[model samples]
Each structure stands twice: as C-alpha cells, then as structure tokens.
Target: MDHLETWEQKGYVQFPGFLSETETNDLKEWVEQISSWPPDPEKWMHHFEQIGPIARPARTEYIIDFHDGLRRLLTTGKVPETAGSLLGQPVVLYKEKINYKYPGGGGYAAHQDAPAYEFVKLHITCSIAIHDATPENGCLYFAPELHREGLIHLNDQGCIEESKAKSLNWEPIPMKAGDALFFSSYAPHYSPSNQTDQSRRTLYLTYNALAEGDLRESYYADKRQAFADAEKTGDQRMRVSKIGHFNGKPPEQS
Candidate 1:
C-alpha cells in the first residue's frame, strides 16, 4: 500500500531515510549543537526525572522556536509534505521539540497528543530519528487505528488508563537515523525506558491544518506563562504538559 493508504489503515506511517545521507549528517551536526546549548531558567529548556520501579536520570527537552535549520526542516523540508499527504491538505507547523532520552531515562505514559494541543482541533506530528531507536533504547510503540476512537478515559496522570491500554494492540516502531514516523494527534503512543547506555533523541514536529491559522508563536508564549505560573506555586508537576506521562503501572512479568 501507498503511504496515504498506510496512514489510513494504521493511523501512522513511517518514511525510512526520507532525508539523504548528507542531509541526515547535517541534521546530526545541528543536533549536536542544539544539545550543547546551555540551560537557562528564563528559557523553556528543561529536564524531568523519575525513580521507583523504573529508575532514570533527567531527560532533556527544548522548544524549537528560532533555529533556522530546524524551521527549514519542518517547513520547507520533507516533514510537512509527508504529513500533508496523510492529512490530505496543506499543513502548517504547530510546535516542535526534541525528547532527548538518555540512558536510564524513563518512558512516557501512553497518551494521545490531541488533548495537550487545545489551541487547535487537529494536529499531526512527525518524529524524525536523530539517533537509532531500538526497543532496548526507548523506541515508540503505537496502538494502531485506536485514534479513530478519539479521546479515551484518562487516568490521574492525564493519560490513557492502564486497563484500556492493555486491551489495545500496540506495535513497536524501531527506527534508524533519518527515519520519520508520522501519526495523528489522537494516536495513542508511548515509549519504554532507555535501557541501553546510549541516548535516543527524536525531534517531534507537529503541524495543524494551514486553515487553522499559525498559532505556534502564541502557543509557546502561553506555555511559557503557564509554566512560569506553575513554578511560582510549587505545584509545577501537576501543571506540566502530559506529553511524557507513563500511562499506568508496568505489567507484571510472570
């Protein structure tokens, strides 16, 4: 089946080596630079951690707002074309971020992307592999076509409940450098903890219908304010976005 067909059938599509080797190398260089950026409390670059049954160190994240290469990658690059083809319409960028899951980094909870993006009704995301992602190192697994059901019961963590998630059929998506995975915002997806010693960094670029109007700037502005307010109240964790939530307890191994 063609890409659009795959998207229609799976609620997600994978484009392997969409970028040429040279382009991929260049992007890797850019990732190196971006990853080295110094942390600033005034900026949105941040880290999170977890410990318990799943132990992990801080995972890093930063919004892509002003990077020229990154902007070009999402706008004039293959990301939008791939996403637009799946969407059957022109798509404009909504937001982008890199989840730098280092060794021992905990996994995200199973959650749909739509609920976190309230500024727009429809959104699609493209995840570009910056490094090889293996099941041993936190590659994403998706519940195929469950997105057609829309939002499901959310647990206290603001993610899909454990019981419902257990009922869905999830398939793992392992990727090599330069591979891209596109999925609807409603798709239920999650990644496992990075058990390997290496890092697994993926750049997630989200877009909405061009007709929805570009809300990227305002969206980040609002997030900055929201997080800033949350910081002031000593309750930041509760207000943090659900992008990386771990849906429920890990299933017991028999």
Candidate 2:
C-alpha cells in the first residue's frame, strides 16, 4: 500500500530516508548548536533529567521559534507537504520539540497524544530521527490500527491505563538517522529507555489542518500556564509536559 493508504489503514506511516544524507548531516549540526545553548528564560526552553549519575538535557521545546534552520526546514519543505497530505488539507504547525533520550534518560509511558494536545480536533506528529533509533536505544513502539477508537483507557496521568497499555501488542519502529515516522495523535504509542551508550534524539513536529486556525502561539501559552500552575501546587513530577507520561526523575537541583 502507498503511504496515504498506510496512514488511512493504520493511522500511521513511516518514510525511509525522508531527509537526504546531506540534509540530515546539516540538521545534526543544527541540533548540536541548539543543544549547546545554556538555559535562558528569553529563548528556547530546555528541560533536564537525572540520567544515571549525570544531569543531562532531556528535551527542548519551541525550537523552530528561535532556530532559523529548523524554522525553514519545517515551514517550507517536504515536511509540511507530507503533513498536509496526511492531514488531507493544508497544515499549520501546532507545536514542535526535540526529545533527547540520552542513555538512561527516560521513556514515555503508553499514551495517546491527543489528550495532551489542545486547540485543534485533528493533529499528526512527524518524528524525524536525528540519530539511529533502535529497540536497544529507545525506538518508539506503536499499537496498530487503534487510532479509530479515539481516546481510550486513559488514566489520571493522561496516559493509557497501565494494565490496558501492557495488554496491547505494540510494534517497534526502528529508524535510521533521517527516517521519519508520522502518526495520528490518537495512536497509542510508547518507547523504552535507551539502554545503549549512545543517545536517541528525535525531532517531533506536530501540525493541524490550516482550516483549524493557527493555534501555535495559544498552545504554547496554555502549556506554560499549565506547567506553572503545576509547580505552584508543589507537583514536583519530572514530566516534560502537563501529562504525566514521562518516566524520568527531575534533576536533584531543579
């Protein structure tokens, strides 16, 4: 089946070598530049986690807001083309982030992203592998043909119920550095901890149909408020988002 057919049938699709080798190399360099930036309140937001004995950067959000290379990459390219095609309409970016799953970093629990994402009824995420993602290094695993069911078995933590999640047979998605995986927000998915010594970094760009209105700025505003409210309540969870799916601990000094 073609990619559209695959997306229609399974609510997801993978495009091998979606980014050319040269493009991928360039992206890797851009990621390095972003990674080296120190924590600054006025710029891109960074989050850290306790990975083994070290406090390593776990995630970076709103990257395209500050990085010209990534902004151009998403705003004008095959990335938006594929996203618009899959969404069945012209699309606008809803949000974006880089998940840096360093060795022993963390894993997200089984969950449907639709619950966490708001301001749009339809959304799809494109995950571009910046480094090879292997099962040994925390590749994503997705439950096939389940997006049609809408949200299901969600827990208080905004994730799939533990027992229910464990019951579904998840298919592993191993990707080479430049591969891209696109999945609906309703798809149930999870990833395991990176056991390998190397890091597994993936850039996730989420988009909604342009007809739904451009809600990127509003989405980020809501997220910032949600996190701040959580902090005020003394919710010291080491989660990357308002959702409690992350399985990592906060750095001791946070």
Candidate 3:
C-alpha cells in the first residue's frame, strides 16, 4: 500500500529519513535562528515555562513572513505537496510551529488535534523531527484506529480523558533527526516528558485543502488577539490544548 492508503488506514504515515541529513541540519540552523529572533508580541508568540526547577523556552505560532529558508522549506521543499497527496487533494498552508520541548519539559496529555482546531474544515499536520525522538526524550505516542471514531471524549483541559484513553492501544513512535510523521487532525496522540539532557524539537506544519481559502493570516490574527485577551483577563492558562501540556511543573521532581 502506498502512503495515501497508509494515511487513510492508519491515520498517519511515518517517513523516516524522508529528509536528508543536510536538510535536517539546515532546519536545525533555522530553529536556532528563529529561537534567537526577538520574541516580539506583535509579530509572533513564544512560551517560556518551568520544567522541573529549570525554565525552558519554546516557539509556536511563528510567522513565515521574512523567513526565506522556512518559506522554501514549507512550500518549495515539498511538505505541502506531500500532505496534499496524502489528503487526496491539493492543500494550502494552515499553521506552522517549531515545538522545541526542552529537557524537563512536561508531556502532553492524550488528545486529538481536530476538536482543538475547529475553525478549519480539515487539518493535517506534518511533524518533522529536528532531533532524534526517543521514549526517554518525549517521543510521540499514537493510538491507532481511534481517529476513525472522530473526536473522542474530552476532559476539562480539552485533552482525551484517561478513562477514554485507557481503552485504546498506544504505541510509541521513535524517529531519527530527519524523519517526518504525518497524521490526521483527528488522530489521538500524546507525548511524555523529555528525560534525557537533550531537547526534543520538532517542526510541525499544518495544512488544509486548497478550496478552504487561505486562512493563515486570519488564524494567527485570532490567536494573537485571544492570547492578549487571555493575558488581560488572567485566563493565563495555555488555552490551546497542543501546548497546554506544558503546564506548571513536570510531575513533581524528586
């Protein structure tokens, strides 16, 4: 079976070493560059959280306005095309982020991406491994076949409830530095906290069908405003379920 079939059946397809080492290295360099880029509240939003007793930073909702390398990587570099093929339609960019889960960073609770992202009709995210992912360093764990049921039972925090998640068989997916994992928005998945000293960074690019009309600008605009609103009202919790996993402390260190 081809990738399209695999995606349709398994909810995702893991393309290990899909990117060359050189390409992966290039992306790492971009991660460094973007990390250093002043986190201006107006342009992009980043999060700094406490991991155990240490504070670590990660960037999300970063705009691709002036970043030539990332622009090429997302558009001309075949990410959108690959996602389009898997989706059985031509797709457009929806959202992008570099999840640099630093050491001691907390793990995400079991959840599906669809319910959290309701603005769009369809969503598919491509996770490109910027560093080797292992169970020890918080690699992704996916629940196969649950995506077919659509969105599952959600908890107060918007994550899949433990009662519901317990019924599904979970599997840890490990990838090399240059691999990519493409999963549907409804796919049930989560990750553990990074135990190793090294950080677990992944570049995630989400896309929607071409017919959906480009909503990238609108999406980010809404997020920026919502974030400001959250701050003003002190709804300071990570409203987005994706990053909400990085809450207070990483499970009380000994």
Candidate 4:
C-alpha cells in the first residue's frame, strides 16, 4: 500500500480497514470483557476527583493480555512491513496502551512523543483506531513537516505551547475502525474533545530500533512489585511471559 511513501510525503499515513471486520469485532469484545472494571476503580475514581472535574468518565490503562493479539497482528507483516520500511530495520514493539475517551472527554493538549524519551529520532508510534474516528469523535490532528524542525523545548506543563499554536496550520487526519495512523514520534499532534455520545477507542503501540537502549525501564519499575505479587500467587508461567513482554527486559536469574 506504499505506506512509507505516503507517510514520507504527508508525515502521516492512514490505511483504512487495516483490520478485517472479524478482527475488529474480536478486539472490541476482548476489551469489553477485560476492561469491565478498572484495575483499581476506587483509586482511579479518587485520582480523577483530586484532579477536579473530569470532562467525562474516561478510562486510561494498559492491557497486557492484548499484547498477544496485537503481536499476532504485528507479525502478520502488514503493519510491521510498513514500519520497517520507514524505520529501516525490523522494528521492536516497545509498548502498548488503550485509550478510551468517553463522551465529552477533554482532548489531550498538543505534544510530541519523543520528548518523553528525551527526543530521540529513532522512536516511532502507531495509533490504531478501534472504532471509527471522525472529527466529532476526536480523531488525531498532526503538524506535518514539523518533525524536521527537531525538538522544541516543552514548558513546565510538559507541552510545547508555541509549536502547538503554530500547529493550527497543520491538518487533522481523520480515520475509521480498522484504519491505522503511523507517524514520527517527533511530530506534533493532539486529539480534540470527544463530543460524540459513543466512546472513542484507540490502540496505541510504539516501536523503536532494538539498539535504541533499554527504553521501557520506567514502565517495568512501576510494575515490579506487581510482578512479585503475581509470582507469590503462583500465576501461570504463560501469564508471567505475557507480563514480561511489556516489562522492557526479563529479570536476572539468581
């Protein structure tokens, strides 16, 4: 589908229906089943309360089980082939997360992905729409060609306000379920408030060169105690393997 060429020219590529009808439905069902309750509903709600009024009752969290499903898709060679063409190597899946924005959910402020990694050029991100994303549904907006400008310092709020003010000149990329949007991690982008009645679901995955250093250390450290607790409970080794996939690296053998 000449994804690399398209992305190179436009700074973003949208492949419609990248997932088949069956595949999309399967993923939706899995999310609904596994996400029936938040990992810590009470604590989650309290955090929102502390933050003041939430635009909507939105849920944000990581799903480890979904990694197997997404990995299967990555290995299928469709998504990875396009990424490899852009990255110039066999890309490694670095992380995955699900963003479910409910009606009236406030939009995320414009920002660059690489800033979180200290602005490394080797980072890339793929955002797969699990449902149709329309303007009203808060589809992503990006500033094309802005990546060439290199890193713009973010303010104390962790946002590049100046760059985002200029980003208004850039275009928004609206996509639908089964469609995927791939862009450089340095690109400036954001989503709008979800004014629609339905939830806006997106599966976001990041890929980086294997030589990009151990990039998932923070993620593993945050969940290290959880892993220890799981081990004590005698969880199946397969479950541990699934958790390890997102842990950045395996623990050292004693």
Candidate 5:
C-alpha cells in the first residue's frame, strides 16, 4: 500500500522488516551496553540503575546519527516523494529521539505533536522499532480519523477528557523489530504501560516543512539543559529559556 494513503486511512502504517536482523541486533546491543554503563561512575555508584533494565539515555551522538540516517533515507526521493505527494512539498526532518519504556514505566499522556509547530498541516512521524513491541510491551495505540477533527486541548491533568468521553476506539499496533511505524503527528495517540518483563525500545523521527523564523529556540534550550542535567552529578537544576523567540518578546529579559 502507498504510505501516505495508509496513514490517512488508519492513522498509522507499519513497514515490516525495515531494517536487517543483523542491524537490529547490533543497535539493540549498543543500546543495552550504553544503558548498562553509568554516566558518572565515580560520583554515582550506579547511575545506570536509574535507567532501569528497560530504558536508555538519549545520547547526542545517537540522536545525531539517527537524524542524519533518516535524512538520507528521506532525501533518496522515494519515501519523501510519497510524502511530498501527500504534503504537497518537499519535507525536512526537524526532530528525532530514542524512546525507551521500561517495565512498569508509565504511559505517555495522549497528545498531538502538531501543536508544538506553527502553521502547518499533514506532518509525519516515523517510529522504528528496535525491539519487538507487543501489547504487553507497550505498543502504540491510536484512533483513526482523529486528525481530521483538529487539535483538542488537554485539561490540567494532561488528559484529553473530551476525546476519552467520546466513543473513541483505539487500535493497538503490534510490531516486530525492524518494522517502521509511520503516522500523522496530529493524530491523538499514546502508548500503554509496559506490563511485560522486557522494555520497549524505539527510535522516533519527525519530519515537517522548514518554516522561516526561530520559534522553538526556547524549547531547544530546554532540551540542551535536559542534556546537560543528564551529565551532572547532583540534583539537576531545571533551566528556563531566557531567549524570546517563542512569545514575541526580545531575546533578553525586559
């Protein structure tokens, strides 16, 4: 099936065997080894322990490589060609991350990724499974046709109560290692808790139009601080964005 049409109909499409078995195993081993090593062995006896057996740190190197690899894949004019057919323009990868959910790890609250961007429609998110994702292992779940309705606001509890209250049916996507899941980021979706013994590992990469102006500088600064905090020894201090690209204020505090 064509990729974008599948996504438009089902809210997501799974490409099985997207990566080779050897490559999958190699990436899995790399993640496992990295997750086992302590960030600062001298200061913390077992900082890796905090990561749990199910999750790993999102290292800058890994993220950069992942982004570059995906960019190359999209630039091949195959997948992006299809994407352009859907979006009506060439697409650019804007964000990428590794998402690892450990056993008993809490689920992500249902939300849309479109709100984070500005003046855009029909963006895409491609999530590659690094491990077998079963219902017990917290596979992704989503409601089809939700994206067409537009973004809904979440309440204080971070729950979309109105959508939940509606007769919304969620379809669980069970995917194997090497399968790539593609979906519209505007769709309301979330992964359930990892009830099994093993962790759910995935590489999530997002693509959108390259818009003019710097709107997410503050968000990126927050991300930079998050990265910095992960390297620090003591209780990490949360950093606020002093830059003003987000809300029409100056770069410096008034």
Candidate 6:
C-alpha cells in the first residue's frame, strides 16, 4: 500500500529485504552456477564484455527454463504476486536477466525500457540486488516521476539524448543484497561503470499484465534476430542488450 503510493508519486518503489538472507544466498549460488555454465547457445544466453585484456561475463538471460529454483522464485512466489499487485492485475513473465557488473564492467545510458520490450505497452521491472549495490558500484540512478511523461527525447540508439539525459534531476538508488526496486517500463534510468573491486550483480525480472498475452518467447526470438542482424551489419555496439542503451564493448571489439 505504502509502496504503491510511492510508485504513483515517484514512478518507482523500493522493497528492502524482499528476499531473506537464506533465500538471497540460494539465489546467489544459483546465479553463480548459471554464470559458470559454458555458453550454451541452444538454451540460456550469455553476453560478455572486454574488461582490460580479458573477456568477462556481463549478463545471462533466459534461465527460468533451465533452473527450477529461479523458475519458482520468479514465477510462483512474492515476486510475481507483488508485480501483479503493482500492475493491478494478474501478471505474466515478460523476460528475465541478470546483469553481472564485474569490476570495471560498463553501465547503461539513460533510457526507457519500453522501446526495446515490444508487444507490450506497459511493464513492471523488478531489480533484485544480488550483491550490495552502491553509488560506488554503479547502482542505478533514476529520474523521479518521469515515467508518467512517456518516452522522452529518445534517439536513434534507443536512449535518451545525452544532453537531455544530463538535464534531468537524477538520484542514485543504493540497495542492499536481497532488496528489490520496482519501476515502470517508462522509467528513465541509467548507471555508471563499477568503480569497486567487487562485482555488483542485479537480477531483473520484468512482467506484463496477463491480459496482454504471453510475449516472452516472441520477445527473445526477436531479440536473437536483432542481435544477428546487428552482427551482420557490423554494428560495433555492445551485444549485451537489444537496445543501444548499454555502454559496453561488443565482443568483436574486444
């Protein structure tokens, strides 16, 4: 209730300790397992970044089908329940991904997620912190109450124009492990490079109203094609996301 009120006024809400310490540890171990799995192009997807002379893991997605623990965590419990509550209807999974921001990993530019997530007009994304996230570790920064403005100054790269992004009043959201931050698809958000020696990981689970129809499979199918197209065109952007908002070195560039 209070969080819902905050969501209306700020376009985002934070739920501290959404996951208990034991649950957080389990999720972390599962993430470690997922991250360690060698790239299986047929199943889960992995993206890499060139940090220094070494290629490091940057992201992993499409894991719910592979890991039962994560599947249940994302699908059955409080996560989806809260998402449905926020959306004011039953919700269906749209997509899920874990951002592994290892030391020196890159951050995203200011952008609204709606442009990249197709087939749904509205969405709610919950960012569950897998590790302590702080301003020094590239935690996300957001512009309060901006989601109601719809898309703002979107550019060719699927991000807000840098000048426009800079002019917005932005605030950092530092969260402890197990904390969850929920925001609208239209929320204007960004982050900087991780300046710490440790990894700053976050699990992002996105959902749409059940009435919108299930678009998860279609979304990933299109994303794969989009990435393939970019590869064919020699697009030298980060391969981490479908959108150009990501600010990382593409695998080829590494």
| Model 4 agreement with the true structure over 54-141: per-residue lDDT tens digits | 3222433444433467557754477766676777776766656566666765566667776554423486777888888888978888
Which residue pairs in candidate 6 collide? none
Task: Give the root-mean-square deviation of each candidate in angstroms.
Answer: 5.0, 1.1, 3.0, 9.8, 8.7, 1.2
Regarding lDDT, does 2 or 3 come out ahead? 2
| Per-model TM-score on C-alpha atoms | 0.88, 0.98, 0.92, 0.73, 0.67, 0.97
Query: Which runs of model 6 end up more than 4 angstroms from their true locations?
Result: 252-254
Sort all candidates by lDDT, best to worst: 6, 2, 3, 1, 4, 5
Which tens-of-lDDT digit does each residue in 1-254 have in candidate 2? 99999999898999999999999999999988998899985667788899767889999998887889899998888998999999899999999899889988889999999988877998899999999999999999999999999998989999999999989989999999999999999999999999999989999999998999999989988888877787788787635887788997788764
lDDT (10s digit) by residue, model 1, range 1-254: 99888888888999999778887888888877776666675654555444345422243343455467876787885779878878988899888777767777667778888877878987899998989999999999999977788888887666888899888788999999999889988889888988998878888888999989998887767777766776688543432363437422222223
Quick one: best lDDT, which candidate? 6
- lDDT of each prediction vs. the true structure? 0.76, 0.90, 0.80, 0.61, 0.57, 0.92
- What shift in Å separates residue 55 of candidate 5 from its native position after superposition? 9.4
Residue 170, candidate 3: C-alpha displacement in angstroms: 0.4
Worst 10 residues of 2 by lDDT: 230-239
Residue 106 Cα positional deviation in candidate 5, in Å, after optimal superposition: 1.7
Each candidate's clash count: 3, 0, 0, 1, 0, 0
**Could you give candidate 5's per-residue lDDT for residues 36-147 as a string of tens digits?**
5554522211111123342323221123332344446544554555445555566665555555666665455566666654444547777778889988878888777777
Cα lDDT of candidate 5 equals: 0.57
Worst 10 residues of 3 by lDDT: 245-254
Query: Please, what are the lDDT tens digits per residue for candidate 3 over residues 159-195?
Result: 7888988888998999999999999989999888888
The count of backbone overlaps in candidate 6 is: 0
- Candidate 3: C-alpha RMSD to true structure equals 3.0
Model 1 score (lDDT): 0.76
